[model samples]
Target: MSIDAFAATSLPVRVGVQIAPQHALYPKIREAVQEVEDLGVDVLFNWDHFFPLHGEPDGLHFEAWSLLAAWAEQTSRIELGPLVNCNTYRNPNLQADIARTIDHISGGRLIFGTGSGWFQRDYDEYGYEFGTAGQRLDALARDLPIIRDRWTKLNPAPVRDIPILIGGGGEKKTLRIVAEHASIWHSFSNTETLERKLGILAGHADAVGRDVREIEISTGVELDFSEGLLEAQHALGVRLFTVGLSGPDYDMAPVRRLLAWRDAANA
Candidate 1:
């Protein structure tokens, strides 16, 4: 579709929680997912990694897609998926099929967030080549359309057009991929960075003949959920705000605060 074909419209503010599966037991992580969902968060996310990204390198960690399958059966309202699945880890067609299966398990609530792999340890330890960033991105750009096509050829097909959330901030390649295939574009951006990137994304979207506004913008915040920062992002057209909750205890305070903020904003 043309970039201008879709009418500009305001989207409802939604809150997501990334329950980081690190330094915590699997049971605890499961409890955290239930707790966050019960608290009314709009989306639940986990990272696609084999090891902890922070704290002790040997900290407790779990795989993302497997946990997502379990979460699919465990929770009812919240949309769930990896914050970004690594494209290099599995075949793109297999990724599509797995996503489709998860969609059915969730009754159509899967959000297929993916990106080119980074984390060198994940590559080295897992025996996958940690190619240059540009090479990985080129692979990603090639695989995305194949993934989407595979979705169509699946036996039962996805329960819905599973929302594709491409997470990254690379101006040239990543944003172009987002423009071409993503239903949601996720990144970690402050107001100024988001504004500039959004302009660049618009150009890319226009180049691809897709509406930039049609791609939902998602960004993450840590413990300090600043209202001012969020308001600035919201003003710049970001609708999805995600907060990361880590390990062991899985604090619900920030999740509650963001949910309240979402309610207030939507109201």
Candidate 2:
């Protein structure tokens, strides 16, 4: 697909930042969240994990949903959620309830991004089974419907049909789930990968009898934006671009660059 193909839909390009909640204190994470919100990004995210993903394995790290609840109260305007919550950690119904509560807490600013669990350490430490990749994906598939059903039965419905963002690039399973359930599909694909995966996604959407473009395309961009990568992906229909920032410093230079790119693209 070319830029013109996506232009008709004209979804405004959005920028989000995933501030890794490892290797830093909660105060620093809070400060970073406030700063990112002040800078006018579209969304804020923290990963769902019990341990650090990089650097020192035993470094300081915080939980995902708990911090999201805190961030919901601390900031206004910016949408927030786990970059992708692990399905292995909690029951699907419980996940729905938790997301709904946070949705209320944030006054409906929550974007419920989730994926099949990947980090094995989290499962072992938490006493959940560290199953095969297929098993986890199968579990996620079985559970997502239940979550949506639970949403209907809740005391007070979500502030809105809280947008579900599904992150992963598995063509066989993950993309199909995105087709069936996700309002936003987040991936770490560049131009080539995105092009191919989107075709697969379209097929999945067809099987499910929905237009593929109804689901927004989200991607993680590299910090080095000098290469025209952003424009290339935009041409292929990706509107939501996010950058991942690690803790300790939580540098904002790249975030500023992404915001600038977003503004120019939207203009």
Candidate 3:
């Protein structure tokens, strides 16, 4: 669950950008963030990791939520959050408290993106336990409800009811948690995998007495397959598609094309 960035829907089209916090200098990433929002992307995302996930392992990086606290204040229109934060990094109550603060920082434009812990490097390097996937997701399952409960009880409350975005495509556990807790569910699977997973997700939704449509389906665009994939996912009831690009030099050419397709598709 090392999502620091995600794409979101806005009006006739939805788009997003992620400025990899660990991979870039803060000022440059900050500038890129401002640029991304200026490009009219709906949501701005960042990942939660102590070290760089790609490129050099020992490259420079920054903490996830703190930068989000800054992002909350830095931009005015774009909704922002960690693409997906690791649930194991912070206690549920503390995470809720932090989210509440960032919620205010963005004047209620924050999306609380979270997921069951993954990325063993982040855990081990940070001195947190690298437990079994099931155990961590179980902690995540327990934690999400508590965070929501605490949100209801907190003073001043969240700036608004911050929307929750949960990532992962697991069957027995992860999707079940999404059915129970997520407002937006991000997936790495392409159309075929997404098509199959949708049924499983629906079963979980039905078991929990929840409507499948209540949780938004989200997928990614990697340039070559983006146009067709976005359309296919949209046909499968996914309106939110994210195109991820990371760098020393952030280029947004493909994002422009996807937005064009989205408008055409919805038209």
Candidate 4:
């Protein structure tokens, strides 16, 4: 196993596990955080969705930021944040303040992962207009800088400069935003898609006069990365790997294996 995995970098490659808060009781949701932190996971992420994404779509669910605040106070050693906050749900300035407060609550370990949201139900239910993907991405592009500038200007300020994580892999618009703004860019494509998207992002970085390497590449690990896949992604500068699990007695056998992969890669 790579000894340090995500934590191998000077800035730490960082492994993230997202706990889906839908379809689970509060206690189960509560214990999931304790479990991952105990397992030495680097980051604990929660999605900013109101309802279940899968497995009985209309099942019981909880709010996103409230859960995050609970997680922030509950854990002491792990970094915690939304895998990507839905920019449509909250105003950018308000989102910045919420993140800033959580940053202090977590004692300087919050990563502000955000994206142009896609879920129509969330927008309709919350009275946020469900716009086109291009429209939403455009709004996200606008909000990201506003949020960052607000972070710098917020009273008492964030404990540290919160790392900006721009989620989504839209080659034309989203990747350009990643090159311009994100400290971490989370994508859910297979190795092939990632390669193509990274090429596009590199072009965006060049156009923006930014180093592509400054932004970390992250992908989900529902299955192991093949040697060829790993080598290819690594060659393209992809480092951080994430595995997502949902609540109420969910198994973590996969996470243990991924953790070992991380250790081996860094060994």
- Give all candidates' CA lDDT scores: 0.90, 0.90, 0.81, 0.81
Which residue pairs does candidate 2 place in steric collision?
Answer: none
Per-residue C-alpha lDDT of model 3 across residues 50-131, encoded as one tens digit per residue: 8888888888888889899888889999999888899999999999999999998788899999998788888877899988
lDDT of 1 by residue, 142-165 (tens): 999999999999999899999999
Q: TM-score of each candidate?
A: 0.97, 0.96, 0.93, 0.92
Name the runs in model 3 displaced over 4 angstroms. Answer: 1-13
lDDT of 2 at 236: 84
Question: What total of clashing residue pairs does each candidate reach?
Answer: 0, 0, 9, 11
What is the total number of backbone clashes in candidate 2?
0
Model 2 per-residue lDDT at 25: 97
Q: Tell me the deviation in Å of residue 85 in model 1.
A: 0.2
Off by over 4 Å in 4: 1-13, 223-232
The worst-scoring run of ten residues by lDDT in candidate 4 lies at: 1-10
Cα deviation of 35 in candidate 2 (Å)? 0.3
Residue 127 of candidate 4: its Cα lDDT? 89
- Put down candidate 2 lDDT per residue, 1-267, tens digits, no spaces: 332343345689999999999999999999999999999999999999999998999999999999999999999899999989998789999999999999999999999999998988898988999889999999999999999999999989999998999999999999999989999999998688888888888888878987766788999877776538888888888899999999789999999999988898888
Clashing pairs in 1: none
Candidates' RMSD to native: 2.0, 1.6, 4.7, 4.0
